[model samples]
Target: MTIPNLENNRVKLSLLDLSNYTHLESIAQQKDLIYYSPSDISTPEALKAYVQTAVDGYYHKNTIPFIVFDKISKNYAGSTRYGLISWKDKVLHIGWTWIGYEFQGIGLNTNMKFLMLQYAFETLEFEKVEFRIDDRNQKSRKAVEKLGATLEGVLRSDKLMKDGYRRNTCCYGILKAEWPEVKEKLLAVIG
Candidate 1:
């Protein structure tokens, strides 16, 4: 099932592909854009490979990746995705989100996430959505927490990072039942 473009006045997310490499090139090279993760998109080749992996996952129906466009700034931002999809279990993870330095703290991310969460709970009929964050990434952990996702638990030394470090993963989740309240809060902020 193909995911259509998810858009609002704040941000637009289109299915990510190789062609998106150009749109993202302008914002992908900033220092530590995604230093917590293993994937590196600092160079042209690395960025292409990164997008290619996401595209391949889409072909395999394993993830729905997106290239972010900040409509307010009128500029391409970065990327995110709905990953680790389990159709039978009706659960998926939302993480791997990164934006340019200029895009940070702009509320674009909250708007974008609100749209995705609404779609996942209402349209896709998913039972739950999860987020895995590096424990040290307080910025992201707090962001997701603000979205009303509960801190479920932590997986210590769960993931390998580019810096040859094994990072602790903090698991957060939003049950479908919790979406109504979360949506209300997000709407108030978005408006």
Candidate 2:
């Protein structure tokens, strides 16, 4: 798929597009942001490795990653990706998301997710869009819940995080049928 851009609201999805991993480097400098996810990647090398792996994975399929930025703040905020694409099946997953410490609880993530889900359902016409979180991540789980995605059950031992521990995945999604209402709720909350 072509890299997404703001015009399509699907701007270039890979860091490679934004100056060959420059975005990753920006994220590496944000020590305060990387800690938000349950994983503790405390060093520069660790952070670089984390982003490199994600870059490699996105290259493997219909997946794509994008760096989030704030024009007003004029700084990189975090990273988010869309992958596990099943175009024929009409499904997609959005995760690997993180925001800077200062940006958290400021409604930026909600607004970002709002734009993404809206693009997927309204712009791209996707039938279903999902958010998967580590089951133990209450903050993330609650965040998705607050956005109005319905809980779709959990997948046990789904995959190992970079820390080499197994993760129980919690799935949440908004169907095309539910998008109108969910979008309304998301806009209300984010706005």
Candidate 3:
């Protein structure tokens, strides 16, 4: 996919790579920032490995990872990605997203999601974008709901968490046909 300046006044998104991996170090050490995640990035070494995994995904041609920058706070917030991308199906899934505790509730996520959703639907011309959140992650689920993704279903014991507990994954989706309305809602809130 072609990429240019991916900022929306409030946030910026750049391809996550080794050169930009240091940008995420500042916020990635926050404990339990992504408690629901199967991987641990709470330490510097682990965070580097986490970034390497994203880079690998990009090379594998299944995902596009991004390092998020919060312009309002002038901070490199965290990371998010479009994974499990299927060009044949015209669909993509957005997951592996997390921001620092300080960045939460600052309208950063909304602005970032607005840009991502726009890119997936309008620019890439994907038919559907999906989000999978752990069932116990109510905060994340609600955030995606705010972006107009509907709960499609739940997959029990879907993923093994870092804490050694299995999590039920909640699948959410927003179709291309629904983007116009979702875009309006996000614009209203972000504005």
In model 1, which regions exceed 4 Å deviation?
Answer: none
C-alpha lDDT of candidate 3 relative to the true structure = 0.90
Least well predicted 10-residue stretch by lDDT in candidate 1: 18-27
Clash number for every model?
A: 0, 6, 0
| lDDT digits (tens) for residues 68-180 of candidate 1 | 99998799898999999998999999977989999999898998899899989999999999999999999999999999999999999999998889999999999999999
Using alpha carbons, what is the TM-score of model 1? 0.98
**Cα RMSDs, all models:** 0.8, 3.5, 1.1
For candidate 3, lDDT tens digit of each residue in 1-191?
55555788899999988898887886888878888889888888998998898889898888899999888879899999999999899999998999989999988999888889999898899999999999999999999998999999999999988778999999999999999999998899988
Q: Which should have the higher lDDT, number 1 or number 2?
A: 1
Which one wins by TM-score: 1 or 3? 1
Candidate 3 stretches greater than 4 Å from native: none
Cα error of candidate 2 at position 79, Å: 0.8
TM-score of each: 0.98, 0.80, 0.96
Q: Between 2 and 3, whose TM-score is larger?
A: 3
Q: TM-score order of candidates, best first?
A: 1, 3, 2
lDDT of each: 0.91, 0.71, 0.90
Backbone clashes (count) for model 3 = 0
